[model samples]
Target: MSTSFLLFFALAGSVVAQNFWFSFGDSYTQTGFLDNEALPSVANPFGNPPFPGFTATGGPNWIDFDTTTHNNSLVFTYNYAFGGATIDANLVAPFEPTVLSVTDQVNQFLQTVASKPASTPWTSENSLFSIWIGINDLGNSYFLSDNRTSFDTTLLDAEFALVQQLVSTHSSLFDVGARNFLFLNVPPTDRSPLMLAEPASAQAMLKANILDFNSQLVEFAENFKASNAGVTTLIWDSNTAFNTILDDPTAFGFIDAVSFGTGPGFFWINTLHTTSPANVFWAEGVADVLEGTIF
Candidate 1:
C-alpha cells in the first residue's frame, strides 16, 4: 500500500481499538489470574507464572479476554479488587451506600463511575463489564469475623439489594440499549487461602455459607430477568465451578493445605491460585458461557 493509504488505515485502526471489558472483584477476576503488567509480584506470589509471579503473558485469570478477539480491539478490563478488600468496608461517601456491607473496593467502583456514566467513552456499546464480587461480603463476615449465622441472615438481603441497585442504576452501561452484558456473581472466596486454612470442622460451615450466597445470586439473576424484559444481561455461574475447586482441590489439579500450594503432585502452587492450565480451564468455561449466553 502507498504511505498515505497506510497512514490513513493505521489511524482508522486505532479508533476501532477502543472496546473494553471491565472486571470488579478480588483475585478471582483481576489480573491475579493473568500476568498483567501492573500487578505486584512481591505481595502476590502467584501473580507470576509458570505459577509464582506476574507476567506479560496474562496470568491464569477468567477476566483475561481472548487476545485474538480483542486484538486491535482495545479491550481493557478493570481490576477493581483491592487487596484485603471486602463488602461494606466503607459505607459512607468515600464509599456510597452500597447494597451489601461489602468493601472499599465496591465503594471505589461506585466512586470511579461518573455521576453521568452515560457519557461518551463509557458507552455500553463499546464495552463489556464482568462483575464477580459479593462472596467477600459473606466470607469475611463469616470467617474472618467469626459470625456466620448472623452475617448470613443480613448478607442475603444485602446481596439482593446490591444486585438490584447495580441493575437499576447502571442501566445505561449494562443494558446498553440493544447491547447487553454478563454479570458474574460471587466466585467462591471461601476457597481462598485465608479460609482454607481453617479447621476441617469449619470447612462444612464455610462450604454451606458459600452455597447459600450463590443461591441468592442465582435468585437475583432470575428475578432481574423476570422483572425486566428489556435488559439483555445474563448470569455466568462462576460460583459453582469455583466451589467445585474448593470442595475438591484435586479435581482442578490442586493440593491445598494452608493455601493453594504446590507440593508432591499438585499443579496449583499459590495460596489462592492455580497454575496456567487451571486458569485456562476456568477461562474456557467463562468463554463458553459468554458464547452460549451472551455474544
Candidate 2:
C-alpha cells in the first residue's frame, strides 16, 4: 500500500454514490455471467433471476458485497467475469469457448455503450470499473522452468501490456464519462491451498514471481494515474490483504484460515478457491479503497 492510498482511505467516505459498478476478470472476481445470462442495465443489472451469480468463493463474492450490502439503492452492478479467464487470449483460454476473456469483457462493455437505448442512464462519472485478473497468467507462467527473467519478459511483460491496453484506452471509457477505476494486483497465490501442497522451493519461486508481477502492476497504476488526469485510480494491495489473513486467520475473523478442509467456512474450499468469509473481507477492503479514491 502507498501513503497516498492511506490518505485516500482516511477520507473516502465523502465520495458521492457511484451508482453503477462494473467488474471484469477471472474466476476469483467472476460471478458466472454465462450461467446467469446477465446484462448491464437498470431493471435487471445482475441477471434474469438476480442472484449473486456462481462464484468459486462459495457464495456472494466481493462484487456481491459491493452491490448488495455496501451500495445504496441508487447503485447497480454488472459483472462480466468468467471462470478461467486471462487478460488476453495468449495466456489460458476460457474453460468454454463462449466465456469472455478480459479483453472480450471490456469490448462487451464498449458495445453496450455504443448500442444501449438512448434512455439508458450510465455515465462514467457515476460508475466504478474494477479489474481483478492475472492469477492464471502467473499460475501458468511460474512453473515453466523456474527462470525469473524469462518469466518477466514472456509472462510479466505481456501482462503489463494488457494493463496498459486497458488504461490507455481511456478514450473509450472516458469518452463515455467513466472516471473511477480500481485495479487489484494478484494475490499471494503461493499461500493458496494448492500452492501450499507444493515443495518449499517451488513455493519460493512462485512467490517471487507473484511479487514481481505486483510490483509491475503498481508501476502501471502509477503511470496511468500520472498521465490520465481527472480519472480516479486505486490499486488495492491484494497481496498484503491475503498474506495478512494467511499469517493470522483468527486475527481476520476466520475460525481456521489455515485449515483447507472439506466443508464451508475454511480458508479455501478447494485447491484454488476460498469461501465467502474471505471474499467478504476482501470486499470490505475494496469498498474502503473505492471510497478513498472516488469520494
lDDT of model 1 at position 98: 38
Regions of candidate 2 where Cα sits further than 4 Å from its true position: 1-18, 34-45, 92-99, 114-116, 145-177, 261-264, 292-295
List, residue by residue over 134-244, the lDDT tens digit for candidate 1: 555555544554555455546555544544454455445443232345666665655656556777657666677777766666666567667765555667777676656
Error of 2 at 178 (Å): 3.2
CA lDDT, every prediction? 0.48, 0.68
Best by TM-score: 2
Candidates in order, TM-scores: namely: 0.62, 0.80
- The residue ranges of model 1 lying beyond 4 angstroms of the native Cα positions read 1-18, 32-60, 65-74, 90-120, 143-150, 159-181, 185-197, 243-267, 292-295
Model 2 lDDT per residue over 1-295, tens place: 1122223223657553335667788899876654225454444456534557778877878877766565443455677787887777656554567667787887776666422335345665666778898787778767776565555555545554544544454454344445677889889888887887889988888899888878877776677667777767788898998888888887766766556654655878778887888888887788778664432
lDDT accuracy of residue 142 in candidate 2: 76
